[model samples]
Target: MSAAYRFSVSIMPRDGILDPQGRAVEAALPELGAVNVHHVRVGRRVDLEVEAGTEAEAWTTVDRLAKELFANPLIESWQIESQPVTARMGPPK
Candidate 1:
């Protein structure tokens, strides 16, 4: 990840969330000729574009942000990764 500069932080639940949208979709599945589906739940992905000096710093910034804001430490788990920089995308110095 050393060569990486820009990072995308993805925050989502590790267990599950009871989603009404998912349930509605699941309920409709059987009528649409799809069956045997015992479980269905919905999860969302949050991508954060952040600025940092180094790859390590980028990871650290997002990690802290996730733990502090995006994720609820009580229920969900999250992960992050850095993307390859094609060209400078952050605010110009």
Candidate 2:
């Protein structure tokens, strides 16, 4: 039987890649009294659910989507985390 799994993907710019948004945030932080902050990188988190027969299958599905549709391979990288969903913790009806 296929099980529901929750996946969290964190996408970020690859190291050494120029991140204008990150740089802007980093610069603004110091002005906001965060003087010790440095090398700040702004990234995005994607939360989703997948149905598959096994954890590996769920991971594969998310990994494929993250690589092909969610993240830019040339400039960004992504990490995936998964957790099986229990009946008691299922999504709202």
Relative to the true structure, candidate 2 reaches a TM of 0.88
The residue pairs in collision within model 1 are none
lDDT computed for candidate 2:
0.85
- lDDT of each residue in 1-93, candidate 1, tens digit only: 233455555544455665576678798998988897856655555554556566677788788877898777676677676666654465654
Give the CA lDDT, 0 to 100, for residue 21 in model 1. Answer: 61
- TM-score per model over all chains: 0.61, 0.88
Separate clash counts for every candidate: 0, 0
Candidate 2 per-residue lDDT, tens place, 1-93, comes to: 987788889999999999999989987896799988888888888888887898889899999999999999999999997744542344574
Q: Which candidate is the best by lDDT?
A: 2
Please name the candidate that would achieve the greatest TM-score relative to the true structure. 2
Off by more than 4 A, model 2: 84-91
Scored against the true structure, residue 80 in model 1 reaches a CA lDDT of 73
**In candidate 2, which residue pairs get closer than 3 Å at backbone N, Cα or C atoms, i.e. clash?**
none
